[model samples]
Target: MAGVLIGLALLAFWLFSLFDVITAPEEEVRNVPKALWVLIVVLIPLLGGLIWMLRGRPKVVRDPWPVPPGPGMPKGPDDDPDFLRDLDRRMRGED
Candidate 1:
């Protein structure tokens, strides 16, 4: 019974860490980020369960794929709306 309880505790910790790492933002990956490293821990519950260990980890932020923002325009999602309004203002030469 004691072993079973310990196993359950490890599983719970693994699942919690897994969910956190999977959803965490990329900018914070340098930090703990809910201890994604837990997946790499041997004899732990999540050791062999992570797909990233075999396949690959995705670039959750700023994928290298091409974007249509074009040159001389803002380069972010925020830039999109501001760029449109800025273009309108520029054409009208308004402040």
Candidate 2:
């Protein structure tokens, strides 16, 4: 009946939550030691999920993806090939 269905639903939900805690990425779960995190999540299921998602959201950077260059590290020479090519073209035209 309705009671049985509700019990199964709750059990399924509980299992899903436990599985998520167990299998969560090490880095994510490592933020809170697994034992403590599991207890907190069990006590505040909605809050735990929200906190995890918010904190784990990947940061996006507008700069080139593979890590930006260090400060003062010029990306290219002032006289890089493209600049030299343009300079040569300008000189040829002028001459």
Candidate 3:
């Protein structure tokens, strides 16, 4: 039972690593050429998966907070001058 569970886990890891390697964009795959990484994962599943997760995956850059719209850009309908003007005209029954 324990052995089967371990085997399934390893299998899942191998499949996930293989899929990730295949789908990753060429520019985003780090440390090795995408083809080489695929080969490594296919040939040595456990170790290769670990290495790929640690070193070959793309580095994700995340902003700590959402960026506000640039100057002159409306964040919502309420912030858009044209939209407000149109709404006012509609309220007054102007064409």
Error of 1 at 26 (Å): 1.0
lDDT of 3 by residue, 1-95 (tens): 99999999999999999999999999999988999999999999999999999999998889777898889899999999999999999999997
lDDT of 2: 0.64
Candidate 3 residue runs with Cα over 4 Å from true position: 66-95
- How much does candidate 1 score in TM-score? 0.35
Pairs that collide in candidate 1 are none
Cα lDDT computed for each candidate against the true fold: 0.57, 0.64, 0.96
Measured with C-alpha atoms, the lDDT of residue 82 in candidate 1 is 75
Which prediction has more favorable TM-score, 2 or 3?
3
Higher-TM-score candidate of 1 and 3: 3
Q: Per-residue lDDT for 7-75 in model 2, tens only?
A: 787666666665677676555454567666667667876666555445532234376667766886656
Please tell me which predicted candidate would have the highest TM-score against the true structure: 3
For model 2, give the RMSD to the true fold: 9.1
Q: Which stretches in model 1 have alpha-carbon errors above 4 Å?
A: 31-95
